[model samples]
Each structure stands twice: as structure tokens, then as C-alpha cells.
Target: MKNVLVTGFDPFGGESVNPALEAVKCLAHLKTETYAVEVREMPTVFGKALDCLYAAIEQVKPDLVICVGQAGGRPQMTVERVAINVNDARIPDNEGNQPIDTPVVPGGPVGYWSTLPIKAIVQELNRQGVPAAVSHTAGTFVCNHVFYGLMHYIAESKAAIRGGFIHIPYLPEQAARQPGQPSMALETIVKGLKIAIDVAVELEEDIVTMGGQIS
Candidate 1:
């Protein structure tokens, strides 16, 4: 069976819980005939997040890696298409570090495309009655840092691993605290993540779909 490693960040921004980590914690040892899933919790800090991810990758030796992060205002699960090498944090991280326009890896490439079948995962999630879409950006926070670091590690080490990042909406409880914010139920988020994993494992290439933004 193919080994799959999924990661989520710890709660940041002073919230009680992080839906991404909670959902991943619920998916331990989720195994099927084709693939087996292992979960890891990454720090919300920029540099340390990548360090944790690299350790997890070494320990799990997974064929595929999906890193999930919380995107509070997003209404649906978004499979990121790219990870840029910039680190421009809008706010301080959990450790109170705020980087302004620093490259994630100095002198590295500008960006890295996700190796996973992003469109296929989005299509499958929508087919399963889950809200999902293809996202072009993973943001310039710790999420993007880890994503770019993972792709760079794969490229530099020549590892046979397909990796990508997914952003999930805030939980209902998290939204309850901030009025007028959109959120999705935990069950729905977990369902969407499982569907994404299944589709990513089954499909080799992304399907041709019109998933673009006008803005």
C-alpha cells in the first residue's frame, strides 16, 4: 500500500482550536487497499514548520504528502496550485515572528507547482457534494512556507513524493467567535479531506476543468 502523510498546523492567531489539526488528528491510521494515511501536526512558525515537516517526511517515508492549514474566511476546502518562495506575514505567528518580504529559501526558485492532481481532487470533492476549488495561492504565511519548503526538498533530494497544500475553512465554533465570518462543519471538512486524499491517490493527472478566478 502507498504511504500517505498528511499534516496540519497547530492553533494560531489566538484561537482555541485549529480545524486543520483537528481534522487530521481524526484521520490516524485511515487505511485502504491502495494507501495508508499518517498524520502530523506542524508548528505555525515559519522556519520551524518546515523543520517539523521534514522530520515527518523522513519518518513516514510517504509516497504522497498533503499539508492542511486553516483559512478562516474561506467557505470551502481549497487545493493549492502553487507555493511561492516569499514570506510576507500579515500578522505575527504563534511565536511572535513576523517576516516581511523575505524569501522562504534564500536564492531559491520563485515558486513551485504542486505535484498532486489538484484539479482532480477539487472535482471529486464537488462530485461528493463537498465545497472545494482549485486555489492558485497558498498565501505568504507559514502555510506557504511549508509548502514551498516541501516542494523544494523534493526537487533537491529527488524524492519520489507528490506533495501539495490544502486550505480549509474555520470551524463553526471558530466562526461563532467572529461574527459575519463563514465556516464549515468539522464533519464536512473531514469528509472533504478524506475525499481529497482518495482522489489524489487514485488519479495520476489532473482533469481539465475550468477552475480559474477573474480577479
Candidate 2:
């Protein structure tokens, strides 16, 4: 069975349950004849996020890596298109560190495009009655930092790891506190992620050979 490494962040922004972790955990239970899944949690802080992500990638040596994060106001699972080299956090991270207009990695490329088949994944989710879209920005927060770091490592290393990031919406309970915040059902988010992983692993061969075929 082929191995896939999935990552989600620990809770941040005073929230107790992050949908990212919950959704990925749901998908982790899927058993297949030819594929095995492993889900892990990473810190949401700038300095620690990348290190944790790298460690997972190295240990799992997965054929595909999908990083998930919380995007509170979104109404669906968003397949992020790009990760920019900037850290402009709206609030302090879990470690109480906030950076403004700083490079994710000094002297690295200005940005990195997601290696996942975003459109295909979104289409599959929508077919299952789950909301999904191709998000152009993963934001300047820790999500983007981890995304950029994963891409950077893939570019430099000889390891055959395909990486991308996904942003999930707020849980129903989280939105209840904020009168106007958009929220999605945890089950729907889980279903969307499962389809995403299946698509990611199924298309691994084409992804490696075609190189950035997602549009």
C-alpha cells in the first residue's frame, strides 16, 4: 500500500476545536486495499509549523502530502492555489509571536504553487454535495508559511513528495459565537477531505509526470 501523509494544525485564535484537524482525522480512518493514510498535527506558530511539517514528511516519506488549516470565515473546504513568501499575521500565533511583512524563508522564491490537483478535487467534492473551491491565497499567516516551506523542501530535496495545502471553514459551534461568521458542517468537511486525499493519491503518477497540471 502506498503511504500518504496528511497534516492539520493545532487549535489557534482561542478556538478549542479546529476543523482542519477534525476533518483530516475523519479521513485518516479510510482503509483501502492499495493505500494507507497517516494524519498528524503540527504547531500553528511560524517557526515551529515548518519544522513539524518537515519532520512528518521525512518520517512518513509519503507519496503525497496534504496540509490542512483553519480559515474561519470560509463556507467550504478551500484548495489553496499558492503560498506566498510573506508572514502578515492578523493575530499572534500559538507561541505568541506575530510577524508583519516578513519573508517565510529568507532569499527563497517569492511564492510556490500548490502541487495538488485542486480543480479535480473540488469537482469531486461538489459531486458529493460538499462545498469546495480553488483558493488563490492561503493567506499570509502560518498556513502560507507551512505551504511555502513544504514546496521549498520539495524543490531542494530528492524525495518524491507531492505537497499542497487546504483551508477548512469554521465549525458550527465556532460560527455560533460570531453572529455573522460562515460555517460548514464537520461531516461535510470530512467528506470533502476524504475525496481530496483519494484524488491526490489516485493522481500521484500524473502529478509527478505532468508537473503543475492543475489549473
Candidate 3:
């Protein structure tokens, strides 16, 4: 059975709960005849986020890693297309560390494409009634930080591990605080993630398709 490490961020930005972790926790104990899932909660801090991710990677040694984060205004599950080496945090992270125009890994490559079958994962999620698409930018925040760090680790270690990041919308309770913000049910997000993982494990090559933002 393949071991999969699914990670999610803790509550940040003065929020009490993070839907990403909530969904991930729901799948923590999943073990099938073909796959075994292990879930981890990552800190929302900038530098420390990667620290936790690295520790988790060391412990789990998963064949696949899918990092999940909260995107408050997003309406669907977004599979990131790439992780840039830049880190430009507009707001301070949980530990009040904010860096602008900095490199995620100094002297690292400009960016790294996701090793996961992202397009195929999105297609499967969408086919299951979960809104999903390829997201070009993970923003220059902790989400991007972790994404870039994971890809860097994979490249530097020369390990054949497939990894990518996925962003989920805010929970309904979170949206109640800010009127007009779109939110998705936690159950739906979990279902979408499960489908995403299933597709990622089953597909070796991504389906040819046009995906990403315009302009």
C-alpha cells in the first residue's frame, strides 16, 4: 500500500478554526487495501511552517504529499500549478514574521512545477461535483512557502516523491464574520480531497488540458 502524507495549516489570521485541517483530520485514519493516509497539522508561521513540514516528511516518508491551506475568498479547491522560489508576505504570519521580496530557499531555482498529476486530480474532483481547477499562484505566503520548500526538499534529496499544494475555501462559520465571502462545507471539502488523493495515486501522467489563470 502507498503511504500518503496529507498536511493542513492550523488556524491563523485571528481565526479559531481552519477548514483545511478539519478536512485533513477526517481522512487521517483512512487505510485501504491499496493506500494508507497519514495526516499532519502544519504551523501557520512562515519559517516554522517549513520546519514542521520537513519534520513531517522525515517521519512519514510518504510517496505522495498534498499540502492544504485556507484561501478565505476562494470558491473551490485549487490545485496549485507551481511553487515559486519567492516569498513576499503582505501580512505577518502567526509568529509575526513577514518577509518581502525574499527567496524561499536562497539561490534555489526560480520555481518548481508540481510533481503530482494535478490536472488529472482536478478533473476527477470536478467530475465528482467538487469545483476544482489549476491555480497558477499560491500567493507569496505560508502556503507558497511550504510548497516551495517541499519541492526544494524533493529536488535536493533526489527523492522520487510526488508533491503539490491545494487551497480550500473558508468554512461557513468563517464567512459569517466577513459578509459576502464564499464558503464551502467541510464535508464537501473532505470529499473533494479524498477524490483528489485517489486520482493522484491512480494516475501516472496528467491528462492533457488547458489550465491556469489568464493574464
Candidate 4:
């Protein structure tokens, strides 16, 4: 069976939990007749997240990699369209590393578009009644850090390992602490991720659709 690795981050920013990890834990070792999924928890630090990601890539030698993270205010599992080649941290990472306006790779490309069928993933998730959308920015934090690193690694190594990043909203409990912030149930996030993975594995060509924002 073809192997696919799903990675998620550990808790950071003074939060006791990360929805990404929670979803990853729920998705471990998911298998079908055609492909399999292996899950790993990456550090929330800048350099170390990439290290853990690369190590997992080496270990799994997956055909696809989906990196998941928490986006506190969003109510949907937003499939990121691109990862920029910068790291500008608004706050320190888990290990207290704060990088500002630094290239993820010193001379790398400005950005990398996700190789997965992003539009298709969003379509599938919404069709299932799980909220989702195409996100234009992964942000310059650790999530973007790893996203860029993964793309750089894929480009440099000349590997056929298709990669992408997905951002999930906070869990209900996380949002409960801060009123007016939207959140999705953990099970909803898991279901959306499963659909995304399936679409990534099965659909090589992304569907043509409108997922644009004027503002």
C-alpha cells in the first residue's frame, strides 16, 4: 500500500492543547486497500518543526504529506493555497524562538503553491457539511515555516512527494475561553481531514473552481 504521512504540531502559545495534534491522533494508521496514513507530531518551534517533518518524511517515504496546524479564530479547516518564504513571528514559538522577516531558506523561491488538490479538498469538505475554504495565507509563523521548508525540501530533492498545509480552527473549549471566537468540533475537523487526504491520494489533477477573494 502507498504510504501518506499526516503531521500536526504540539501545543504552543500558552495553550494546553493543539487541535492539529488532536486530529492527527485521531487519524493515525488509517488504511484502505490503496493507501495508508501515518501520523506524527511536530514541534512548534521554527527550526525543529522542519527537522521533525524531514525526519518523518524520511521515515515514511510517503507519497503525500499534509501538515496541519491550529488557526484560532477560523471556523473552518482552511486548505492553504501557498506558503511564503518568510518567517515573521508575532510571538515566540514553543522554544521561545522569534524570527522576523527571515527567509525560510536564504535564497529559496518567494513562495510555493501546494501540490495537493486544494479546491477539490474544500469542495469535498463543504459537500460533507464540514466548513472549509481555500486560505491564501499560511502566515509567517511556525506553520508557514514548516510549509516553506517542506516545499523547499521537495523542490531540492526532486522528489515526487506531493505536499500541502491545512489550518483548522480551535476546538470548542479553546474558543470558550475567548468569547466571539469561532471554533469547530474535533470530530468535524477529523472528518474534513480524512476527506482531504482521500482527495489528495485519489485526485492527481485539481478541479477547476472559483475560490477567490476580492479583498
Model 1, range 124-188, lDDT digits (tens) per residue? 88998989989998999999999999999999999999999999999999899999999999999
Give each model's whole-structure lDDT.
0.94, 0.85, 0.92, 0.94
Model 2: per-residue Cα lDDT over 1-215, one tens digit each: 77888898989989898888887887774678867888998888998988888888878888888999999888878898899999999999999999999999899999998888887888778878988877888999999999999999998896777889999889989999998999998888877888888888777432222113365
Candidate 4 structure quality by residue, lDDT tens digits, 152-206:
9999999989999999999999999989999999999999999999899999899
Model 1 lDDT, residue 87, Cα: 99
Q: Which ranges of candidate 2 are over 4 A from the true structure?
A: 204-215
Off by over 4 Å in 1: none
> What is the TM-score (0 to 1) of candidate 2?
0.92
Candidate 3 wrongly placed segments (more than 4 Å): none
Clashing pairs in 4: none
Q: What RMSD value applies to candidate 1?
A: 0.7
What does the lDDT come to for candidate 4? Answer: 0.94
C-alpha TM-score for every candidate: 0.98, 0.92, 0.98, 0.99
* Lowest summed lDDT window (length 10), candidate 1: 200-209
lDDT of 1 at 149: 98
Tell me which residue pairs clash in candidate 3: none
The list of candidate 4 runs beyond 4 A from truth reads none
User: Who is ahead in lDDT, 1 or 3?
Assistant: 1
Give residue 190's error in model 2 in angstroms: 1.0
